[model samples]
Target: MRQQERLGLILDRLAKHGTVSVLDLTTELSASPASIRRDLKALEDQQLLKRTHGGAVAAEVIYELPMRYRTGRHQEEKNRIAQAAARLVTDSVHSVGLGGGTTTTELARALGSVGRSLKVVTNALNIAGDLSVRSAIDLVVTGGSVRPESYELVGPIADRALAGIHLDLVFLGVDGIDATGGISTHDEVEAQTDHCLMQTATRVVVLADSSKVGNRAFTRIAPIEEVAMLITDSAAGAPDLERLRAAGVEVITV
Candidate 1:
């Protein structure tokens, strides 16, 4: 196949499966890993894909932009971040708290495929739906008021549930993350719920795309130091990254 046609096929696979392992790509493409790596590198250079430790993912899935805006942006970045964050989980982690948002939803989806013995606590109805049918995983949907726009279960009920539970890790997604504001959300109730979620969890990981850096939304959830890690795409600029590091947050860039 022509190089252009081959690269197109790789991207199509990435779009279809959220993520692709290099070994799988090697088999499917019927090409040398070296050749596939070169193809991936070329596509990454064009911003059409983002390379992970094992494979390339479509780049349009990482944005915090509204659903319509996210429709065609950063797929590879989100997959990369989701995969990176997934590696942090082990079978020993019996319980996890998942925040509301597309990225967190992606994390939930990734986890569903990998771990069979996990108890997931989440306020996102869609996230609950994604894992509900998976008999291998235990799902806990926090009872709360629903925010239809974001599909999040927020407000007092959500906050109370978080207060009563403890988790190994809280996978948090945000509308904006800024040096000044720390972690933030656009809705006050969601912000309050997020704060409670963070407080109950042993560790907090702030999952966001590069575009979210330096942007402050309407409410602050927690300070930067409270976040154990910030998993973001490579598009996050050096200065923003420096700030995150200086604040003592481990920044993982994929």
Candidate 2:
């Protein structure tokens, strides 16, 4: 990857978990240790991150990562999670709510390609943009000011739009997935609207990569038990799955 793209990816990980180790980046980005170190140095020089002995921290306390940075991360894992999530939509279900996040955006494309006459309600402008031109899917955009980083509409207006409609299912993408504490996003406004969307759906399915398994973010969307199923990648450990299973959540790993 180019230097700028690598820096954005590096910052993306820092924004997600607040810190990132050199070893992790070497594995995640398929870059050499020397290259990772050089990138970290550049980011620190730019004051975008704080360099540590073996890792880095975001320059400022970060909530959500910009879409540009996050879309390229865990590409295969996100694709698998998206496919697993789309399977939940069936002939019995006509409408669905799609929460904003890189993973759910992939699920939107999967749904669209399947050519189902599905009604999809979304708060993310990116997801809307992807499906808006397609005639197969009925798309509804919740009205609210966009949170530019995630391109999600979050506010009373979005909540109001979702409050009046009930859907067959809602697929949520979260920043963190703690088996006991529940799911969460980086921003409180997004969390509020996510919770509202959850209430409007009969069943809620949460899509997350294994990286977020034990993490926590700023705002809570709902308890783990409230979700109908958890779709993730095989990188998830057995212990985490057991914990979620103990909480009565149906866990599906792809």
On lDDT, the candidate that comes out on top is 2
Clashing residue pairs for model 2: none
- Tens digits of per-residue lDDT, candidate 1, 1-254, equal 56665676776677668777779988987988888989889878767779999896668743222342243346688888999989888867788899877788789899998747888898899899999988878888889998865788999988888777889999998878876569988788888988988987899999998978778887888888789899999999889888888888899999
lDDT of 1: 0.82
Candidate 2 lDDT, tens digit per residue, 42-124? 87876778999999887874434567667778889999999988888889999999998999999999999998799999999
Q: Which candidate is the best by TM-score?
A: 2
Question: Which regions of candidate 2 are displaced past 4 Å?
Answer: 2-5, 12-47, 50-60
What lDDT score belongs to each candidate, Candidate 1 first?
0.82, 0.88
What's the TM-score of each model vs. the native? 0.73, 0.84
Report the C-alpha displacement of residue 202, candidate 1, in angstroms.
0.6
- Superposed by TM-score, candidate 1 places the C-alpha of residue 178 at a distance from the truth, in angstroms, of 1.9
